[model samples]
Structures are given as structure tokens and as C-alpha cells.
Target chain A: MPELTARAAPPLAHHFVDMRQQTEAARLGMWLFLASEVLLFTGLFTAYSIYRYLYAGVFEEASRKGVELWAGTTNTFVLITSSLTVALAIHFARLGRGKLAAALLGVSLLLGCAFLGIKAIEYANHFHEGQLPGKFYTFAEVQGPGASMFFTLYFIMTGLHGLHVIAGMTVLAVMAVRAWREEFGPEHYAPIEIAGLYWHLVDLIWIFLYPLLYLI
Target chain B: MPNGEHQTALEPHHGAGRYVAVWVALCALTVGTLLASRLSLGPPWHLLVALAIAAAKAGLVALFFMHLWDQPGVNRLVFATSLVFVALLIGLVLLDSATRFPLANPPNERTLRFEPPSFETHVQPGEREQGEPGAIGRPPARE
Candidate 1:
């Protein structure tokens, strides 16, 4: 593929290079997309920080008791392992191993489901304990009532991430089906790679969230 | 919509091992950040360290996880512009929050009796005399 020039007979993605240009273009788009994601989550992180500052003691105590560090840790490991598998999927796809890539993608999806299932259990427990935010929170251990704020952010942030996990799983499922069909090959596997990128970001966010919510 | 426009369909990425290495580095950084948070660091340092780690993690994700590092600089420029915009957005928000109260002048009158409509769901199950409809939503976490 010619550098920066439209090919007269381009077999590349309509918006990209021959395979080379397409890869670069797609990579660029993912970064821009990720930038947007960073900004989106930045709002939540900022809010959490400011709130923690104002109620440091309360949040500390809540952090110490309100959340299960083990649960969060397990989830973190789940995500990171899935990230590894997704990375492997991309690796295999690069080697033109579509079936393996698809299989790994499926494994990642299962792990994602496991993560969500754990998240659901955690959320349900919080709700049962009335660990929600605002005035409604009623956990016996969260003294000063202001501690509800921590749980509020906890639920909202993790809940949002859980939703993303669901979305990611749907994407993985589709890719797995495509891989099974032998659609992605030496010529086409960008979807798997992009999906890998998205999954990694999800894992990265959890890495931060785990400590923020669990470790004081 | 075009074939190349979306990366969803394509051949494998080059330098796959490099991206994998970056991902491992990211995992290490995550553990480091968690350890750093446990120290009795001052408030500013605590935030600084955490944010630094976050920046590193985000960089790794962007560079390798997303392969932006391998792409042309045009994409980087676009991504950077959005960063600036996001900073601006956050700055404006901080300014609004910081200046909510007058430093010098005292308020002539403040109303405690009148209830403001809340964006969050009612925190309590029962309704009070001043039942505000707007308050019926999830309680937004301030932190």
C-alpha cells in the first residue's frame, strides 16, 4: 500500500489502507474512542475524590468495612485473566488462527459473565443491607450516616462498569460466532483486536476501582 | 460503515508481542498503585501518586491495548484535543463548585423551609410533607 495515497485498486478497508493502512487507521480510531472513555470516567473519579476529601474519615471506615476486599480481588483477577485471554485471542488471530482466537474469545466471555455474576451478588448484598447513598442508607456499621456516600459511589461506579461488561460480552459472543464461521483470517481480524482493546480498558478501569473501593 | 473505517474486520496486528509486554507492565503498575495508597503519604502525594499511576495505566492501555502507539500521529492529535476539552470541562466544573459561595459578602437571606427539587431518588422510603417530585431518582453520589 502506498503511503498516505488512496489506492486505485484498494483491497483495504474502504476508509483505510491496504491491510497496513487499515490497521493504522483502526488503531487511531480506537485511541480517539478511548480518549472519550477516559473523559467519561474522569467525571466519576473526580467526584469520588472530592467527596472522599470532604468525608475522609467516614469513607475510610466504610472502605474498611462496607466492601469485601476478597470479592473485589476475585473480580479483579477475573477481569485480568479475561484480559489475558482476549490478548491471546488477538495473538492467535494475528497468526491466522481463527478457531483458536474464537475459542479464546469465548473463554473471555465466560469470565466476563462470572465477573458480572459476582458483581450482581455484591450489589444485591449492598441493597439488602441498605448500603445505598444519600439519606436512605441504613447499614448498622456505617456510622455518621455520611458513610452512605461511599456506598453510593460504589454502587454507581461498579454498576456502570458491570453494564459495560455486559456490552463487552455481547461483543465477544458476536466475534466468537464470526470466528466459528471462519470470517476472520489473514485478511480480516480487526474486530477481534478492537474487541481486545475494549476488554483491556474495562480491566484497567477495574484495576483502579478495586483499590479505590476496597483498600482504604 | 466502510470496510476499513471500522477495525472490527482486519488482519492480525504487527508487533503483537510488544503490546503484550505493555499489558504486563500495566498489571505491575496496578499493584504498585494499590501498595502506594496504603502508605501514610500526605494528601497531595496520595492523590499525585494515584493519578500518576492512573496516567501510566491509561497510557499503557492507549498505546498497546488500543495500539494507538503504532498508528499515525493524526490519531494522537485528535485524541489529545479531546483530552484538552475534557480538562476544560472539568476545570469549568471545579470553578463552578469552588465559587458557589460568596467569600466576602454575607447572604441577605437564606431559605431553609423551602425545598429544592432533587435530581436523586428519594433517599427515604416514606414521603414528607414537602414531597418534591423531582427528588424521585437515584441518589447521586457526591464523591
Candidate 2:
């Protein structure tokens, strides 16, 4: 009888007493996962802080000379716009506008791709200029004790963030497909909401990364 | 399909306008931070201003975009706790490094009394006294 009832109401899990409990549990679980993700990045942020403190001059010099401020700023705008789209996607999903939600997700996906494209160009410039990390760093202009460390942290922090961007893009792609299939509606849109949370988190991390790495 | 009661509890319905407004604010903050970075504030002020702007941007994303504002307290608490730990990790590490003895830091041009190890110069074994106070890998006295 419970199995039959669970089959009748597809959105509510067997353990959940109702849709409310189910959605709340899913949201709580997602938040817990996001919290863990925050901690993961926090480690790298701590490393950045320590190095920046120890070598303030070289870090600023490297940021000013080696980093492409325009590229970083452009990516920041791209991601903020993507985050808006994803949030709008969630809003539309809850309103049972599946097609519009899917389209918005598509737009967000393109924005994410644009961010990666800009990042690639920046990476190419860095490679050509010998602004590599660690021992591979041979950029003559910023050479010093802490100069390479600046690039080292730069590559590590931004590289990890790039991976997160890829992950967020993959999740958004899946959500878009699901939404297009009308899998998400007012009765059941936890997946889209959860995915939006992840995407927003990616944007949040980059918000800090842009300033800490590229700007100052 | 008498789940009408549950429908109201699923998630709060937010208008598209609210999100658009947040987006606009985010973009404005981004531009503001970019402009702030150009100023010659120097030292920690530049970093503080940049971080403050970034925090505002992040808050908008987390609260509105991520729906933390409508979320249950547990979810908000979970995220806030993680942020607290992040502050702790960064704060403690920075405090440790900032307060360490000058010569305790790695040998760098900026480090006070930072002297290159004598071994790098390939000093002959008998060239320096065996137990000299400031010889071979010893940090010079602070001025």
C-alpha cells in the first residue's frame, strides 16, 4: 500500500511524510554539501592569504603586471549574469514555466562557456609570457623570491575555480535537459533549485577570487 | 492528488523581478569594486575595500539567488557555520604568520635580517670558525 502511494505521488520519497518534508530535506542536504564545498575552497583561500601577507609587494606587482585585469573583470560579469539566469530559471521552474526555465538555463550555459573561453585566452597569454607556476615560472619581469609564489597561487586558485565552473556547467546542462522534459514543476523542482544553489556557489567563489587574484 | 496543502509549503514563490533587481545590484557592485581597485589606497585599505565589495556581492547571491533568505534556519545555519570556520582558518593562520619572529619566515628580501645561507657561497670547510655565533645558516642580529 505504501509503495502504491509512493508510486501515485512521484515527487515525495517513501520516507518523507509529505512533499514539504521531502523538499526541505533535499534543500538541507544540498546546503550541507555546499558548506563542505565552502570549506574546501577555504583551505586554498587561507594559503593565498598567508602568501599575500608574506609577500605583499611581489603579489601586488604580479597581479598588476602578470594578471589580465580585463579578462578577470569580463569573466566576473559573465558569471554574475549566468547566476542571474540560473536564479531566474529556478523562479520560472517554480511557476511551472518549463520551456522558459530551460531556455534560461541554456543562456546561463552559454555564459559559463564564455567565462571559460576568456579564461583560456588568459591562460594562453600567461603560457606565452612564461608566467607559469612554481619552477616552471620563467617570467623575467616579475622574478623575485615571492614572485613565482604569486603565480603559483594564482594558477592553483583560479585553476581549481575553473574546474568548479566546468562542474557547474555540467550540472546546469543536465538541469536544462530535465526542465525541457517538464520534469520540474511547482510540485517538484527541488533538482533545479539545488543545481541553482551550486551554480550560485560557483559564482560566489569567483566573486572573491576575482578581487583576491586579479584586482588586488 | 490532494496535495494542495503541501504545495504551499514546498518553496516560496519568488517573482522574476526580485532576481533581476539582485542581478542589477551585483553588476553594480562588480563595477564599483573594479573602480575601487584602481585607487591608490595602498596597503590593507585596498584589500579591505575590495573584500567588502566582494562580500556584498556574495551576500546578494547567497541570500537571494541561492534562496537562503527563504530557506529554513538549519540551511542558513549550516552555510553560516562553514563561513565561520573559513574565517577561523584564515584568521588563525594569518595571525600566526604575522606574529612570528622576523627571521623565522623563509629567507626573502623582505624578511628582516634575511641573510643568505653561507653554504650557497661554497665556503671552504676551514674558512669560518666552527662555533661562530653568526656563521653558516645563522640569522643576523636584529638592528
Candidate 3:
């Protein structure tokens, strides 16, 4: 029934009444999907949390011995800044200045790329150090693989997040181009706003992940 | 999206200053969390505090930057649902992990007695064949 209604949207979707409805519905849906995603990763986070709770020293040792604390911290900064760009982009869109909006989005896209590039370096360092996964880890300084699970989760969560960063970059880039052509304004700025929401959610997820994987 | 739920104008939700403000706030919050990470808030609190701060930052982004504040009232419901479900999944999973611990203790010296030992193992098959005590072993760490 919901699908029917969502499909009923004007040749666009069933859930919306107009383009505004479509945009809002889609944005809301994205957030909802993200919520599910948050939970999905929560499983891995929960595992990491429990083990770290029980073996605080192991988790701490793993962070120090295996994880790239510096790189993780740097990526944290990059993500937040990218989020700022997207947010500002939305603001520019609201002001009916498509060109400036697009420019801000471009900045966001660039920062997002920078984040992935930095992440690649972090992953490369991890790989070079043989912090792969499971029994394959080779942290020469660590006690054993017990602490490596932290790294394992660290990689998985951050890797998944990196993928999202890439995805958000693509979305922002496309929207930036469209926005530059004046496809959005006060009445048609939903895409820019939606993109901002998604980007922020990505940042939000990482906010929790950063402390878990890097700090605590 | 255009619908007739109480019909409203698609007026813009943010201004240039608002955009800048959200960005500034986001930066401040990110720096705050980074600094907060330096603090040893203890187990869940570390995650909790970081997330709380992140949420505040994200709220600034969402409300000001994304202009979700003016989009539609229903969108908030969507956000709520997503958050609730995510929380549920986290709650359920953590409940399982947390409850399992008190019911059992890991065997002290990485042993392979009962279940498949959960920790890492350094296996020396030759030494094990020679009845070496350290051959193929681990600390009992799984709950």
C-alpha cells in the first residue's frame, strides 16, 4: 500500500505529491535508510565495544600498536569540513544563487576526495604493516590477535564509511554541475539540501565511529 | 515534494549567514569532539559523548545547511524512524554481547579445552607432536 502510494507520485514516485513532495520524501527516505545503515554498522560497533570493554588494554594496545591514530584523526577533520561545505551549499541554494551553491558543493566534493585519498594512505599503511584481518594480521609489536579485532572492526567500519564518502562525493559533484546550470533555486533546491543531509549523516556516523575506532 | 497536506510555500530555509554559521558550528563541534577524544571518558561514555557532540554538529548541518527545518514536517518523522530503528538494532545487538559476558569467563591461559578457542594461536605442529605444552594454544577469551 505504501509502495502504491509512493509510486503514485507524479510519474516520479508513489510517495510524493509534487516535486517538492518527491524531494522531501526522498530526503526523508534517505535518512531512514541511513538510520538502518547506522544500526547495521552498530552490530560491528557493538562487537568492538563489548570486546574493548572486556579487554580495554587489548583495545588500547591495538589502537597504539596497529591503528593509524594520526591518519584517523586527520580524516575526522576532513569529513567534518566536507560536511560544512555541503551544508553551506544548501544554504547558498536556498538564497537562489545556484552558481555559488554549486561552487560550495564543488569544494565539498573536493574535500570528500581528499578524505578518500587520505583514507587510502591510511589503508595502505595498515596493509603495509599487515593489519589486514582475522588471523592474517601481523602487528609485530602487539601481544596477539586479540587486540587485532579492534583493527579489524576499525578497517571494516571506516572502509564502509570511505565507500560512503566516495558515494557522497559523486552525488555532490553531479548536483554541483546541475546546480551551476541553475537547476535549483528557492523552489527547486531540494537536491542540494538532500545531498547536504546525506553528507551530514555520513559525518554523524563517523562522529561515533571516530571515537570508537580512534579514541576509545 | 509537492503534496497537499496543509499546503505550504517552498520558501528557502537558509540564508548566506545561516550557511556560514552552520559551517562554523560544525567546525567547532568537530574540534570539540577531537579534543574530547583526548579525554578518557571511559567505555561507552567515550562513544556517547562523541556521538552527542556529533549529533549536535549534524543538527546544525541538517537544520541550517540542509534546510530540512523548512522542507516538510513529515521529514522529521522519517528522521525519527531511522534513528529509532538504528537504536533498536544497536540496543538488541549490544544486549546480546553484554549479557553473554557475565554468564561465562574465559579460560585463563589460552587453552583449547572446550569450544574452539576464540583468541589467536601460535601453532607449532612439530612441537605439539612432541607433546610441547605451548604447542597450538591460546588464552580462553570467548564468552
Q: Give the TM-scores of the predictions, in the order they appear.
A: 0.73, 0.88, 0.75
**Whole-model lDDT, candidate 3?**
0.68
**Comparison by DockQ, 1 against 2, better one:** 2
The deviation in Å at residue B46 for candidate 3 is 4.3
lDDT, model 2, position B38: 91
Residue-wise C-alpha lDDT for candidate 2, range B40-93, written one tens digit per residue: 797879999999999999999999998888776799899999999999999999
Q: What are the per-residue Cα lDDT tens digits for candidate 2 across A32-51?
A: 99999999999999998888
Point out the higher-scoring one by lDDT: 1 or 2. Answer: 2
Deviation of model 1 at A5, angstroms: 28
Residue range B25-87, candidate 3, lDDT tens digits: 767776788788778778668767877886787676556555567666766776677667667
> How large is the C-alpha RMSD of every model relative to the true structure?
11.9, 6.7, 10.3
Best to worst by DockQ, what's the order?
A: 2, 3, 1
Q: Write model 1 residue lDDT over A34-112, tens digit each, in one string.
A: 7788678778877776566456777878987888766887787688778878877776665556677789898998899
Give me the overall lDDT of model 1. Answer: 0.70
Best by DockQ: 2
Interface RMSD of each: 7.3, 3.9, 6.4
Best by TM-score: 2
Candidate 2, residue A54: how far the Cα is off, in Å: 0.8
- Per-candidate clashes come to 13, 0, 16
The 10-residue segment with the lowest total lDDT in model 3 chain B: B105-114
Misplaced by over 4 Å in model 2 are A1-9, B1-11, B112-143
What local distance difference test score does each model get? 0.70, 0.86, 0.68
